[model samples]
Target: MTLTKDYKVLSCDLDDTLLREDMTISKYDSRILRELQKLGVNVVLSSGRRAYDIENRFKQIGLEKDGAFIIGSCGCEIVKVDKMEPICTKVLSNDTINVVVDYAQKNNLNLGRNLFHYSIFISQFKEFYYSTTHLVYTCQNPYNLEHLRITNIQPLKVDYEAIRKMCLESPPTKLFITEDPIAVSSKILPEISKVLPLSSRALITKAYFCEVIPTDGGKGPALQWLCRNYIHCEMDEVVSIGDSANDVDMLEMSGLSFAPSNSFDVAKKAAKEVLNWSNMESAVGRMVNRVFFNGTFLMTDEEKADSKIE
Candidate 1:
């Protein structure tokens, strides 16, 4: 099959979809990504991660200097990967954040503050560290509120009522709430959906956390935006591959979607095709070879067998 030149962009989610379990990109995955880009496919990283966090990852992969676009903070911020320039940004007002923080303190609930292009702020440093270890490595920056730079703190207040109001009113691109995020997300996602908006989707990357991103923010809108605004391609020409609930939107939105064997049922249902192998087995590289390069590539027989097995 000849791949179309019309699709020039491949927008992808970061955590469970693109990055491996160790939070590192595999050699196979990176080679495939670079090859795809050389074939004229623009790879854009889209995630609920903060822009700085995602930027650091891309830098690790040597893609930070390659002119990719990153949609971070659940679409609240969009930036150019090469220059690290902010293309657009949306922040909750300071007064709004303060109100939410005050409420959380009064209720004895933990709250995390996401600073713009800086570190996150929290009321209890221990709670924050325990909750966000997978996403953020621990920092020595003193938890003392007095010592930390006030300018870097942009507090994101955590309150269900306030969050619900925000959802009803302005509606942030994403919102999430979990009592024990690590325990609830991976095992029981449908149950979590009970409290969340039906229109929105949920993804659990870390054991204790679940993300509530825009129904469109999934790989779909990110790809759509890249196609229309950046690469000027059509939706039907693009192809996406992923696994898990977070990959659902992108799977549905892409011209063609592929899922690994270990993917969640919801993601499998949405995928156009399911790869026989899982991410641990290099499914990403196999799919890229099949779709983009017409199958003339290096791959293990197990991988090839898996691709054709089902």
Candidate 2:
């Protein structure tokens, strides 16, 4: 699809969308984003990733100094490109956090603390309690309930009952319950919805982990925030791309949304168009080049035919 200046912004999810499996951006993708900037199109990174994590990856892409916008920790925080100052922030209350921690301890489940700023605090026995706690931290889930003291942790709380009610009423931006993300999201989400109301617009993205945020928290809201606050652009002027459920919201909201052939079925269904290539084939790069520069960098039919034969 031909994108017009009305779509002057590009918002995207990170994992399984902009980044390949190795958590790296392809050179072609990086170049296309820079080229889009040259066309005065704003590129915004919208992700559940922490600000630092997103910033580090952008640095690797050699675009860290390009003044891109980031929506991190879901839509709870927004940061300008290269600037430490945040334009927005949302935090849960400490009492609510205490309640969650206590419930997890009582249930023999692992508890992880997201500071929403610097570090993620996990239970000492995280390994036993959570399947992939080891990936995020060195300490295991706490074995002893005696050590479950809550102190000095950044105080944040969300009314579990209220959140549950909200989730049920409306879809959450993202819902994360256990380390086996798909299982929890599929099984637990409906159960949680029994108690909470979810946003109708919420899109669930399952990974090794799950997180709960606003239904609008996906790339869509982050991009909207950037366009209104930073870029002064409109929604119809942007193009978005991704490969998973978390990308659904942005994909639907964008003037044009592209998904790789390898994207999840749900994501592909939501996209306005599907790219011929997968992430492994640098599909994001191909779409960016096509949309922004009218460049002809996509792989040829012969290349695909050769690869399939190999």
Candidate 3:
């Protein structure tokens, strides 16, 4: 019943695992995590999201002082939630950034930004993914400029100077290129990978998003680093939860792993068990209940079908 039997540290994805589609944490899930933290468990947020966003999320749930750590930028950086400062970081070299920019410009492909705290994405076309009203995803808008801090990349000519300056001044912690998911996966990624310096790496985080970071940066390795350097625990004391292709490595590295019923195939395959509820239904609370209390982790087929029921 006690987590002392296994995990001492927990790493969870931010978007789909902990936060709801509205980017808010449920009261039930928050209560479970806060209670677990009070019981001496180290809960960490692992995400491709920027450090700024993670800090704000912790602030939103009043966990900024609850003893938390963030493996941000898909493991390119780590920050302490209490301090709001990066403990360690890995960034793509300036030379590498220039190379990528040059390639994108020559090909007329739009690339995202990787600033110190957040990533920037501006729609270069009318139908870009982040612009999807159904998705409601954006780092910056005029109403919340201070928090979003994203560099607009629209109206190509106007943004050119600003974009160039940002690249020269900001070393990318992790950069992304957004387009038609189909084009990104099929033609763009393969062609770019062939030219990137061997020191850099790129992968698909979403259908319309391809993330570029240092070759050594990965969420699993970052989790390992956190265990060794920050938490002082063995890999066996760690638990990971995630829900996408990007979360595959972190899921694989954990002593215990779980994915929502609605998670992608790869993430589910990486988990030792699947939760009875999906994220919208607060699957995270159920996961914590199973881990820290005498709670069930299994689901019947009917219950599974009902996970999607409104």
Candidate 4:
């Protein structure tokens, strides 16, 4: 059955949801999104990525020029693209940062491995930081670095002293930690939670990444804030697409939600529909066709027959 409900806002996650496996938005998908925006839909790029990273990469699609919004850092930041102005932001307090520092020093989960435990510092500067004992060094999450190559933005390395100074002088939007997936799940996750204040929260956004931000900040809350104050839309009128645990909040709140076939179980369970196609197969484009174009946009008979990925 064709969907009859009206949808005004299209909130989409970037990685493994709207973007292809190649870390780019396909031409077909980009065209569909542009068309949706032209039709007066408020297209929002909601992602766990930093706002700069999202804007730098997506500006090529011209969504910013069309008055789109960006909810970045998994919801710690919200920006209106056209004006390049922040609508809302949440930051980890200095006390919270101090606590995290102490925890990291006391619990050296990666001690003596000679391997870097990369972490990102999200703020005015897009910097990547890592630590060994009491000394902090510059590093990059190799996976994130691959994506940053698209933007040509260099990852800055800083010392532990620099991080401490920043925390005291100007708090950051959030702190990101990346390490071995097994260690992240087993050790880092629980220990970090215990050290953080009730006002601060840590969540595993990906298999090897844990992000710390203000307790009130998250994709769900950010979506709610935008709808209530700016977009003036109901949660039920929003269409959300995501593929990770971090997307669960926004997915559950949307009236129409989708997860790609390759999505994590949590995302699939949260979404109303799970697409047949994976990200590499133009999942976003297919979903756009099915929902907005009535399953006919750019669909050849052969493609339609092969729509379901085995």
Candidate 5:
């Protein structure tokens, strides 16, 4: 069965939706993505990841090219790929970040730090190593500066004071708090919500990671903005796939939505349909064939058995 509506944009979630468990896009998925772009469909990578990392990751799979856009930092910014600059962006205020920082210190949670800028001449790079509990910067100069290596070779005392100073200089895209999942859900998030301003919004992006951004920032809002301004399409002309709390908004906003077999119950409820195949089995590729190609190619025995058109 053919889709009732023609989709113009495919806004996809990164980690557990498009990329497999091994953190690689399958060849089948990559080919479908390329084929979509060739047919004048806009492919937007909407994720909680930093835009820089998303571009780099897509480059490895040979998907980074012109006409591509990124909704990064969980919708705080939108970047036009070829330009390498954000056509639109929103950032947390210094006062807001300071409040969260104080709460983190009081709760004994690790606050992930990142530099707002990366300059080769200054011998600095941005990092998103969210797993590290210590406050450290792994400085690697792109130009191969020998002197810079000595300072970053050992973990410096980049304490809370450093984070405050950095925030004053330039506000961060988002603030991340990492702690035990139970603590994060039970005590940390609820308490911190009372202290933060009403304009601030927070969500659990991962089991142990809570991300705070502007109230208007999120994958759903970002996609709405892109549809109205960039792509010039209605919300009903978009198809999306994702599998987490962060993906709920985008799933609800799309014309057609899909959740993998392993997705959270909340995500599955939000999606229009749940695929039988998981991410590892190229769920995105199979869905693409069914939606755009009318199930003409790449059908497996399991998929044929499970196939039911909406």
Candidate 6:
């Protein structure tokens, strides 16, 4: 449906939609995003990464001041990018965490938790699940676990008992389960959700991940809350873009939903339209162009040439 009003909030996924193959936002993508914000658009960086991690990325790209309505942990946390003030947080209760941990332990699944300000990981093989966790928060999924080892984003390790204790002591914004998505979805998803109360939710974010969260959490519900309570705009005044199964709910709820050509077929199916260009080809810049320039997303030769990531 074409929105009668211009979208106020442009919620974009970080991993694939904005961050290209090298985990860097292209120059063209970066330029156009700030331009849109100048057009009175609030750029919402929605990701499964911790807020601090997301903020650090923005700082690296000099867009820390440009991104607003920072939503993290797959919508379990919402905070303003400028002051890092939290607007909302959904933590899984102790009872629910115990049940999920028991299941993960039995299946030898890798379990993790992201705090609002920090990260805590609980698993038998801490290093084994690094790339998978990185994918949910950063990209489609990293091809090299070795690359993650050299990076500084590793989560603080804690045992299963510690994970459970932390959940009881202080709830996690979201619970991250990294495994074969198909395996988890088919073999473990039903079991995970069956034990949780009606207030909880579980989702398979990618081919190798499952994000168990509060039922009230997820991009769709989070966006609604932000719109109704903070932005005070109608649902039709938001644009959302993403590239994975975790992005489905947000895309479905957006006024104008877009999926890059590289996006999963399932995610493309959920969007209002699909971009012909993939994320590698400045797809986000093109999408922003479409939003502003009457559906013709193009770049000048100079801008196109300047768009290449280092």
What are the lDDT figures for the candidates, one per model?
A: 0.57, 0.57, 0.70, 0.72, 0.73, 0.72
Clashes of each: 4, 37, 0, 0, 0, 1
Estimate, for each residue in 1-310, the C-alpha lDDT of model 4 and write its tens digit.
Answer: 2333368888889888876655777666776687777777788889987676677656766664545778987898887765446779888887887877566546532211011234656788454332322212234456445434433444555644556565666676677666677877898989899889988988776776677889988887899899989889899989899998789999998889999999989899999999887887778877877777676567455544443333
RMSD, model 3, all Cα superposed? Answer: 9.0
Q: Candidate 6: list runs displaced more than 4 Å.
A: 1-5, 64-67, 115-151, 295-310
TM-score of 1: 0.65
Between prediction 2 and prediction 3, which has the larger lDDT? 3
Which candidate number has the best lDDT?
A: 5
Per-prediction TM-score to the true structure, in the order listed: 0.65, 0.69, 0.78, 0.81, 0.81, 0.81
Q: Clashing pairs in model 5?
A: none
The TM-score between candidate 4 and the true structure equals: 0.81
Off-target runs (Cα >4 Å) in candidate 1 are 1-6, 64-66, 90-113, 118-175, 178-207, 213-218, 299-310
Q: Is candidate 2 or candidate 3 better by TM-score?
A: 3
User: What is candidate 2's lDDT per residue for 35-96, written digit by digit as tens?
Assistant: 66666666777776655567766677666444677777666567765544467655433333
Instruction: Work out how many backbone clashes candidate 1 has.
Output: 4
lDDT of 3 by residue, 1-310 (tens): 2453457888888877887766677766776676677778888888888666676666666563535788888898887765455677898877677777776667666665643323334466222111211111222322223113222213222243455566568676766666677887898789889888878888877566777888888888898998898789987778888887678888888898888888878788988887777788778877887776757434444544434433
The 10-residue segment of model 2 with minimum total lDDT is: 127-136
Residue by residue across 132-161, what tens digits does model 6's lDDT show? Answer: 233212222332242243234555556677
The sequence of per-residue lDDT tens digits that candidate 5 reaches over residues 218-262 is 888899999899889998999999988788889999999999887
Candidate with more favorable, higher TM-score: 1 or 3: 3
lDDT for position 38 in model 4: 73
Higher-ranked by TM-score: 3 or 5: 5
